[model samples]
Target: MDWDKLRIFHAVADAGSLTHAGESLHLSQSAVSRQIRALEESLNTTLFRRHARGLILTEQGELLFEATRTMTKRLDATAARIRDSEDEVFGELRVTTTLGFGTLWLLPRLPRLFALYPNLKIDLMLEEKLLDLPMREADVAIRMKEPSQAELIRRRLMDVRICFYANADYVARNGMPETAEALADHRLITQSPSSPQVRAGLEFSQPFVAAANHSAMTVNTYFGILQGVIHGIGIGSLPDYVTADFPDLVRVLPDVQSATIPVYLAYVEELRHSKRVCAFRDFVLEEIQSFRRRALPEAPETGHAMTP
Candidate 1:
């Protein structure tokens, strides 16, 4: 019934694991368990059915979740309203992104963000795997592919162009490709293999000759892959924005045969009205828009135009 208990309940419901929910709330596993137990006892119903992975909500828990969600939203709105009156942006903002984007783009820009809002703290979570924002692992997410559903809010920040790049040494030794079809001639470094259809985020028209994991001089991290490409290790398909600063890593070919990717800034419906969330969201959008304008002068004229 209390705000704290409801918050813990929501966390348990979302994370489905004590350890994860505890990490999100900055509480110990025992503390989280106690809170949830107290909450269920107060409610006089079996809210959760504990399992090996975590706890699943019972039918009553599911029903109560609807009301709890509404209550939490209103409570957050009230807090935000008070903070606005006080003229302070103070809260924890959980953000998620991929390895490359997280290391290359976001990590460097965080100092400026802290200077802008001294009271606000940021929790950055990076995963190769996708995260569900509505479930509360992340407050904001930057994803590559287009959002599947129309219900979620998404703003395309950039028309991400992809092409092959490699270090000067690798290119000098193995040689560079003149066309997209010519990439087959050289050695290629990659991270972990994806689905049978996708390899290193590229779907080859023909077949690829060879690949490597981390040990094969193939790395998965953005910085790692970029370093390999810079050192002339091997060629790999990478986002143009990712390799823009590294002069050592040059594009293999000028042609844009690789798939067009989008960099998106998205959040959950629950945080639509949150001041801290919206402030950061709007700031990122403004910055990205300026970057897009500078980077893609003829974006509309070209086939790489972004959709509304």
Candidate 2:
């Protein structure tokens, strides 16, 4: 019931030590202990179990801690939104995207963004799992497919195609496959079909995996597959975007390509006017335009859109 007690409890639960929590809160250890004891008495439950190591949360404490954690996240979100009202594009912007795209494409281009907004703090969360933007899991997302979340402001970014490529040395040794059927002769490297990936990419590799009698080296992330290909492990099914940076990768079966996977940038409707979000959106748009010009000269320009 007491806000201050809840705050102290959250800190103690987080740090798992009275002294540590006290140091962070700028309180004496005895004061923190007294508050914890009083809060436990108020709640009529044992919140923590003290031992020689540190404090361990009781079942009740775990439940209370979860509530306090949510409260903290909401508070942080509010503070971030309040900070966004200022005339500067500064503060933390949590960005989430697939590991492949984040590392291969976005990470490489981040220096330009940092150059423009030195005060900007970016927390890039790279994974295949889609985070809930509306729930404040992340501030923004760049997904291979359009996000299905409601109340999101989505903008179509670009299309990616899964195509076969191999290192120049590997191609020189194994020779390029002229047809889909010819791929049986060479080792294949790719993301596992069961891994979380764009449908188009998985579908593209299916036939090759079957042709190789499931002998392909499958990895969970595109970066792993890229490394395998780079080391001459095998011809890899990779997104076409890699060609811009990895020129040494020779395209195999040039006529064979996966259906285009649409990439989309999305954020909660609430963040539509956030300066940090605007700066990031604009930076990505500019970089996408530049990328098209350099890497995909023939790809038509697709302007940004505000779709549900």
lDDT of 2 by residue, 112-202 (tens): 9999999999999999999988778899999988888768999999989999989989988878788888898888998987789988888
lDDT of 1 by residue, 1-308 (tens): 68898888888888888889999999999999999889889989899898876688999999888777767756665565566555577887878888778787777667767888899888888776777665565677888766675556776777665566777777677677786556756656554454221232555322343532222444555566676777666776666676434656667776643566667777766567677787787777665655456655556522232332
lDDT, model 2: 0.90
Q: What residue pairs are clashing in model 1?
A: 167-229, 167-232, 170-232
State which candidate has the highest TM-score. 2
Task: Tell me how far the alpha carbon of residue 232 in candidate 2 is from the true structure, in angstroms, after superposition.
Answer: 2.0
Cα miss at 129, model 2 (Å)? 1.6
- Each prediction's whole-model lDDT (CA): 0.68, 0.90
